[model samples]
Target: MPDAASNDYSMLRDAVVFLLAAIVVVPLFRHFRVNSIVGYIVAGIVIGPHGLALIRDVEGTHRLAEFGIVFMLFTIGLELSFERLKTMARYVFGLGLAQVVVTGAVLASGALIFGAGWGQAAVIGGALALSSTAFVLQLLSERGELSSHFGRVVLSVLLLQDLAVVPGLAVVTALGSEPEALAWALIVAGLKAIAALGLLLAVGRLVLRPLYRMIAETRSPELFAAATLLVVLATAWGTAAAGLSMALGAFLAGLMLAGTEYRHQIEADIRPARGLLLGLFFMSIGMLLDLATIIPQLPAIIAAVALLISSKALIAAALGWCFRLPLPVAVNAGLHLAQGGEFAFVLFSLAMGAAVLPMEMGQFLLAVVAISMTLTPLLALAGRKVQARLEQRAAGGLEALMTETEGYSDHVVIAGFGRVGRTVAQMLDARDVQWIAIDLDAKNIAQARSRGLQVFFGDAAQDAITAAAGLDRARAAVITLDNPAAAASALRNIKKKLPDIPVIVRARDASNMGELMRGGATSVMPETIESSLLLGGAVLRSLGQAESEIDEVIEFFRRDAVEGGQRAADDEQ
Candidate 1:
């Protein structure tokens, strides 16, 4: 009984320490525009056993933190549907397959040259050949580049790497088995994995939508959230039970729900939990680093880290270029994915436990991987700078060529394609007005493209996406993003990029209209005011008033609303 109480107390203390570390470290890192992931890792190191010893239960912490990855994968799945995946099939299978194979072979050869046996070399190569999906995705999302052409290629590669984990683990298991039984072990693992995948797909397609619909009909937010959690955990457990990664299961569950109407709500509900747990996951990784052991071999570790990053980066870039990606985009993707991934730790740990790899070598490799991960944000920043330079130097290069092929000129660029934006687009279409739309919702983009609308999937706040949309050649721009903060940000970005271009923005209410105008919107239409005016017009018409009189009354109210918003802006100024 006493031991149980002590364990509970220890867990509570550790949680407090973790939160404190994040509270202090994350904001500091964000203030400098650094990736919050780096901050989380640094926080982990500070409070970990190697640092202040604020948390001694490393394994327990790791178990809890792993859900972060599961949740992250689920959210990523929500962003993609089967149709989009089918479209990306070539990159996923071709570029992704080539990347893993070539990168693994090169690393394995190097390992062999360094005196490691075939089994150990294979493990090392397979593990290091993959890149950290969590780190790369978070970075891309932060920079608003996840929907860019470069980001799409990178995401395709990451998806393949996630799938490759099953085979990688199978190889590790086979290596641990007796010589005569190795082939059998691999075959069994493969069959089990396929069966698990098939079961997940079958169950998800049939069960998830109905489950969500039933829960949503209750109009209970709590029940809906609980249902979301259940689906994520159940699917994750299913895959892990079959000797597959839990994250993969969660991703599959999300993919199933991607086509459903509840996707956006589920994503919103899971976001907070995902961020918190994912940060904890990074902290757990930091706890794994033993500075005392690493200091003695600092120089060698640094050398290995450099080699691992450089080799992976160059190999990825070469393959991407060969696969017909532009030099800049390919190089950027390579640098973003150059670091050793989280799976490396899993593979190395398994190998060490199975007595297939020496503890000393595994520890050394883990340290190298950790250091490389810590350097990823910096590496990605370097890639962006390099890409900018290359793009500048090649003015009429691939980017310009692609833009020319799209043939955008004197068109209205719509920053959002929600209901309001769609209505505006339709009205423009009726008059044959040339226009293009950009949105972050992959599902929405897929549906729009199917109907032959010139809508693209990307963040309008990103200069690269805006440039690709031919913002320079656009006669006007419209900002109708549903989120107020997102709408304001889009307005500011457009005004900054092209101050001379007329920009129309939609506001949620009159209170938001002044803020949008202050952000340099040429005109702001508050939805609430417009709806109220229309309703008032209807009421007057029902009272048998003349149609002309009702129109005049509504116009008077509209002018008053605009004047009121302008007055508010003037008062604030």
Candidate 2:
């Protein structure tokens, strides 16, 4: 066995090698039109087990990578507050449910083809169903898609996966050498996990926010960091005590703190730690790229990548379609989600430890998962290209909306150009109303403009964004990102800065309506009410109620607006 002093020395040496390789190789990937993530993986191989064999602290390195995931979850939790999740109910619930069912089914079938037992197949399928939250979120963020319709769908599906992965981890853990007892343990563990999540949400709403506010008031970054760390550690400990993964507990802790005031600051402070650990993680994975193993396993590994991507992509596409997304969106979400991910390694490890899978299968799974991780970004780039091409072909019809409407000042401003909001803008347009559309969704802005509409790209929640959208010059502002929490926050900011700006906010359902009203929205409306009304109006017109009836209703609403009655805004968000 290696001496303790020698082990420490070797670990330090590996760190230098990993950093040096990352610095040199990252640039090369950019030059070659490859993703930075791909570069990191390649660099991992070069300085890891495959090339120089310079990294020796394999276990220690991965433990650090684990922190990369922890910080990452904290950031995700901060971003995805309950209010944000509310508006994304359709995608989160609809698309998310579909992705889990469909993808899990497909992967399980493939495992069955390999003659695995039902329990093993369940483990494989469920594990395969989880896309890499870390990788996909980072990619979309860099490409700026975390807020688009498709991005919303991806986000929803990812959230579901996060919730689902906990059970998956339990499932793998339960299938120990004594399968029957393990199965019962797994069932008990899952129930406990669900209870923990409920407790997290409850405690967060009741206690975490106040605690964080108290910390924030002190203006101590160190104290804030310590509190965050405490939350994660405590929650993680609680979860393990109940027989779940510590990661799951950490994630719940993040979810609890998501509603806190210091979420953004906490994320900022912890990000540096995440960044460093992420590098070390990639380095550790690189060490696994042993040339000796890979050379013999290349064919099988490449085949696994193809199989995993193709299979998972098809399942994801079906789920997207089931969620009623546009065809292009469905296809792209599928492709983007096709890869095997880091969790595959986790599941495989558990499987190996339990002797459910041979050591050979675990090694093979590692190689295949690594390859799929490398391909994920490439798949995303491909999806972007495909989406662009589809948009270009569809641009002819979009041009009609871009015909340059003049006299936009002192008019209404719509912040998001998504389909629902765009429809509202169009209805107002047919009446020759003056309004300028603002959106952070570049795709939506581009599409809107291609059709002859006057839409600008912007984040309307920011003072800078509203200023760019001519908020002060505009008579009214419509908050329409479909995210209730963000919408409420934006409404608050607008009220503070320009108290007289009449703001109409949208909601997914009644539960969201009150929050916006409390936040100072002039009116709040749900999608269903408006859609039903439009259909009712068309039927009335067909029955010969006369165009005057529609005109009269509009006039009445305008009159009601003076006294602030129930005219309900568009709920497109």
Candidate 3:
């Protein structure tokens, strides 16, 4: 047995090797416009036992790298809200479910044709069907495209796959010696896992917000980080207890926290952890590639990688097109998700452990997954360029609104074309006001345009849409969105980019008044307060009150409104 001192030295040596490789190779790769992921993987292969033999403990390194994925999921959850997730449910459940089922079935059929047993083929199919949530999401986050249409769909599909992978793991574990008995066991376990998830979400909804709020009040970064870590571990444990994966639990915990107020701070605290860990995770995967085992099978490995990337990409693209995404967006999303993912490592290990897959087959599949992942960033970059070209070609009709706004000055930019927006536009039009309006609701724009309003179909909060509305020369902006979240986002976007332009916003209640003002609204009109004041003024006039008395009452209410707004704003500060 090795002494403690010797073991410590070994660990230190391993760390130095890993860190030195990353430091040297990553910058070089980045200088060539290659993704840091490729660099990390390349570094791993070089310093790994298969190459220079500078580092040992590959399995232990892989285990440590998993925390990177956990922290990454946690941060991803912080960026998403339950409301936002709900909006993507169709894509998550529909497209995601279809992708797995169809891809798995087809791949399994192919595997069987290649002389594998049905059970083993099933395991391979399930494993290869999953795309890398970590790799794709990290890329999207780096590119700042997570909020784009293609990114949202890819995220939804990945989330569903994370959940879907649970059963695949179970299936792999069960398919070994007693296929029938364990298959039934997996079914029961899957049901229990679903129940556990439901229970977690229910309980999290009840207490997560309040719990984080309490943590926030303490105002201690250490305490808050501790709490976040606790939540992540507890959630992971809960799912593990139900025979589900810890990563799934971490993701759910993130989803719960996404609905809370402390999300941004939580994200900030965990970002560094996610980055380092993710780098380690990628490097560990690269280390798994044994050139000795792979070189003789080079032709076969290349064939498998090409087949996997092409089949998966085609499936993803076809699904996106079926979902009615724009041609470029569909193609881009498909290309982004073409590669095999991290989950393949888990599935392969489990299959090998259970003696379902022969060692040689498992190694080959592992190489395929690793190589595909290494190639993904380059493919995504090419896809992005192709998408840009397609978008440019398709830009003719899409540019109509921007063209209409060109060379115009002193025009009001109306952000919503709803009831209130229509009223405001009508009033402005009566005075010959030149204005351009953008709304996400196409039907609303169509209706308004039929009635001769200058309305267009586009999200006002989108930078492209706003710029097209002539923000540089706009006289002012009027926001009349009924959705408080959307209104707040639009308010911030406009204020941040066009601070010199004055803005008037319509608010549903006083609850949001302070936030709206803080977000840089020049004026916030509460619908209830304005309507009540209008009614009260009309009633006093009908009561035959003196004109001077009516004027005084109106003036008093207006002054009170201003004071109330000011107080709300101050309290927010």
Which predicted model would earn the best lDDT? 1
Better of 1 and 2 by TM-score: 1
Off by over 4 Å in 3: 397-573
401-492 per-residue lDDT for model 1 (tens digits): 34642777898989888789899999998998888887765445557778977776556787877888888888899988867778888887
Off by over 4 Å in 1: 396-515, 524-573
Worst-scoring 10-residue span by lDDT in model 3: 389-398
Ranking by TM-score: 1, 3, 2
lDDT of 2 by residue, 32-68 (tens): 8888777787887877656776676667777767766
Positional deviation of 535 in candidate 3, in angstroms?
A: 23
Candidates' RMSD to native: 6.7, 12.7, 7.7
Q: Candidate 2: minimum summed lDDT over ten consecutive residues — where?
A: 396-405
lDDT of each: 0.87, 0.72, 0.84
In model 3, residue pairs whose N, Cα or C atoms come closer than 3 Å (at least 3 residues apart or on different chains), thus clashing, are none
Per-residue lDDT tens digits of candidate 3, residues 510-544? 77888888787888888988888778888989999
Question: For candidate 2, what's the RMSD?
Answer: 12.7
